[model samples]
Target: MFDIYLPIAGMQFNALILVAIGFSVGVLGGFFGVGGAWVVTPALNAFGFPMAYAIGTDLAHIFGKSIVATAKHRKMGNVDMKLGLISIVGSVIGVEIGARNVMYLTKLGIAGPVVRYIYMFMLFGLGIYMLYDYMTKDKRAAAQAAKVAAAARAGLAPPAKKSWNLPPMIHFPASGITISLWTVSGVFLFTGYLSGLLGVGGGFIRMPALIYLIGCPTAIAVGTDLFSVLFSGAYGCFTYGIKARVEIIAAILMLVGAAIGAQVGVTAVKYIRGYGIRLLFAIMVILAGISVSLKQFQLNTASQWMVMCAALGMCAVIMIKLYQGFKKEQAEKAGYAVKEVKP
Candidate 1:
């Protein structure tokens, strides 16, 4: 009933499915500070859209959604403007390189399987590492504390934290870090390359890099990454459009749902803690990897259903957390008011 003809891609697709996919990713994107292209591209492809068209349409929608997500993050003081600006310089150049590579691969008639395999590898590798990091954080913290205490007892200075500390260090007071300019640029460039290659905003990779590599706090990482994503998404959309890969009607339908969903996702960030967000992100990506794997194995129907179900399930979890947190906050406010009146 909701089917619509897309002239750009020359296909009939369900409008409701596009909107639903957008809403799911919108919530995930706003909370996770990702463009959610990882989700959108795969979901679209599974449902019969061509790989190139899926990527272009995904990037186009991401550009609009990031605006809403970034604005909300900025208001919450999570954005680091300085870091975000630096990221754009490297990212833009890197994206151009990656986009050209995709075009070459598309011409070879091997874009589909090749892209899916790479996507699966990235999702699984990153997700596993994050889970391991979360599991070992406390042990690592204790070990570092012990080393400091040992040094102090021996009348020696505390052990120095190791870093590159190359010349021309840059300081970001918002994230409370001072690091080499080279390191920041290198990280963004690599992420941008992946963004162009994989039809992502680079937020999934960059968010983790900001926290682990650059030493930004997780929340700051989320906000700052979104700021960077805004630029990359814009560039990606334009480049893909020029390549004649974008489906304009599909992009618009997705954007409508994303706009509303972004608001809810951003608000949920207030209720969830930094570690909580990381854990959820890890799980989401791992599930995404599995979905892509199913596609690689020729189980197209199963892959389509798996991704849609996972997106809906994750969205439900986030909304429930938000509701619970809101109720608790209200109760505390009411209790405080009662105590003040009694006095």
Candidate 2:
């Protein structure tokens, strides 16, 4: 009953599947500040969509979903406008380059496997690194504290973290980071290229880059990455449309679900703290990588189920957290009000 014709992709796809995928990804995108393409592309491929078409359709939906997520993030004061704007320049350029490379791979008839393998590698590598970062955060903090104490005992100031002092350093007041312009450009360019090649919103890559590389707080990184995603998604949509790779019908269906899910996801971020977000993201990424790997092994059905299950499970966790946090906040407000009335 939910199946619909997709002229662009020349297939009859289930509308319910599209919407469900969009909804789950929307929640993830909003909370994680990612484009949700990593999950969407793999999910679509598992369901028999051509790799190129999956990437294109995923980008189209991401453009719409990002608008909702970004607006919400801005209201919460999570966006770093200056840094986001700077990222757009380098990202757009890198995206074009990556897109061109995909077209070349398509001509060689190896785009599907090539893209999937790259996705697997990147997902595993990034997820493991982030997990390590989260695991050792306390140890790192203690070491820094010890250094400060030793310095104090020696009657000296605490030592500074070493950094590049390249010319034309730019300061982002929102993130409170000052670094070389060259550094920012390099980071975004690399992230953008991956986005183009992988058919992702590049938020997954850029979000962490913003945190570890650019030194933005986790929430700020999430918000700022979404801001950059808006532009990249738009460009990806247009370019892919021109190449006749986008499935418009599927994209619209997905957008309908994403719109609603984005609201819930963005709200959840308000309740979840930085470390909490990071840890959850790490787990999700690793699971997603495993799903993609399954697809590479020709277990398409298994891959589809795994990714869908992961998305649904994560959504449940996020919603429960949101509910609990909302209740706690309400209780606190009630207590404060009662005290004020007594006075």
> Could you give candidate 1's per-residue lDDT for residues 37-86 as a string of tens digits?
76787789878999999999999999999998999999999999999999
Task: Supply the global lDDT for candidate 1.
Answer: 0.88
- Residue-level lDDT tens digits of model 2 in 195-304: 88986777878998999888999989999999988987898899899999999999999999998889889999999999889988988999999998998999878887
User: Judged by lDDT, which candidate is best?
Assistant: 2
Q: In candidate 1, list every pair of residues with a backbone clash.
A: none
Give the C-alpha miss distance for residue 31 in model 1, angstroms. Answer: 1.0
Q: CA lDDT of each candidate?
A: 0.88, 0.90
Report the number of the highest-TM-score candidate. 2
Clashing pairs in 2: none
